[model samples]
Target: MSRTVFCRKYQEELEGLERAPYPGPIGENIYETISKKAWQDWLSHQTMLINEKHLNMMDASSREYLKQEMQKFFAGEDYDKAEGYVPPVEKE
Candidate 1:
């Protein structure tokens, strides 16, 4: 059986990640509190932010910006969005 966590993002008990996403305390914390679904959602959003904002991961500032955004995102607070971006419509 899979582990379940009281997901901070969803505020409900849900299936948890199999392991920490990366090394360090933050990863551990996420493994304990963040649901897999929430993590995946963040990844998609992160990619959109990177592409729309033209962020270079090699740049320290860009990485820091994403870090801050990640915190806000999980906290359910106001986070940066890709400006002037529109979602593509799906065909029936």
Candidate 2:
């Protein structure tokens, strides 16, 4: 059986990540508190933010902005969205 956690984002028990996404305390916190689904969602959103905002990952400010957004995202606070971007409709 897989591990389960009370995911911070979803606010309920769900499947947990097999390992921390990266080294350090924050990653360990995510492994303990964030669900796999939430992490995947963040990745997709992060990609959209990077592309739409033309963020340069090598820049410290850009990285810091993403880090702040990531915190807000998991905290269920108001987070920035890709301006004027629309989601594709799902097939029935």
Candidate 3:
């Protein structure tokens, strides 16, 4: 059975990740508060960020920017997105 968490991004209780995505306190906090679905969404968003911005993972500042952006994204704050990106409309 999967675990559950009160997802900060979705603002609801949902299935949680099996393990921390990273190996630190921030990862611990995410495991305790973020749902698996939300984390997956972030992964896609992160990919877009990296690609659109040409962010180099080897750079300390790039990693720090991503960390801050991740925090903002999950916190329901205004976070940066790929320039000229238009979110696809969902069909109901």
Candidate 4:
């Protein structure tokens, strides 16, 4: 996908999140930090939406296509030496 389209789609989700309300400090912190449990909760909610609205909403194919594109993007670089390829766990 073109960067413009990708940004447009991503901007919408981010804007939605910006407008969403958090009920408590912990929930607000999770939304900002994306902690493991928060990630899992987000994953579960997304999964439910995917299963129930495969045809009703969301571009399901976009996920698979983006995955392949991202893989292709990183295939040429060495994991240990690649520029801007920091492993999350290894980051300090």
Clash number for every model?
0, 0, 0, 0
**Candidate numbers sorted by lDDT from highest down:** 3, 2, 1, 4
Residue 82, candidate 4: how far off, in angstroms?
Answer: 41
Q: What is the lDDT of residue 68 in candidate 1?
A: 90
* Residue 53 in candidate 3, Cα distance off native in Å: 0.6
Query: Per-residue lDDT for 1-92 in model 1, tens only?
Result: 99999999999999999999968998999999999999998998999999999999999999999989988898899999988899778899
Q: Across residues 12-84, which tens digit of lDDT does each residue of candidate 4 receive?
A: 2221233213468744543443333334444444454345444233566855543343333223322122234
Off by over 4 Å in 1: none
- What TM-scores do the predictions have? 0.93, 0.93, 0.91, 0.27
The whole-model C-alpha lDDT of candidate 1 against the native structure comes to 0.93
* RMSD (CA, Å), each prediction: 1.1, 1.2, 2.4, 16.8
lDDT of 3 by residue, 1-92 (tens): 88899999999999999999988999999999999999999999999899889999999999999999999999999999887977678899
Give the true-structure RMSD of model 2. 1.2
Off by over 4 Å in 4: 1-32, 55-92
- lDDT, residue 66, model 4: 35
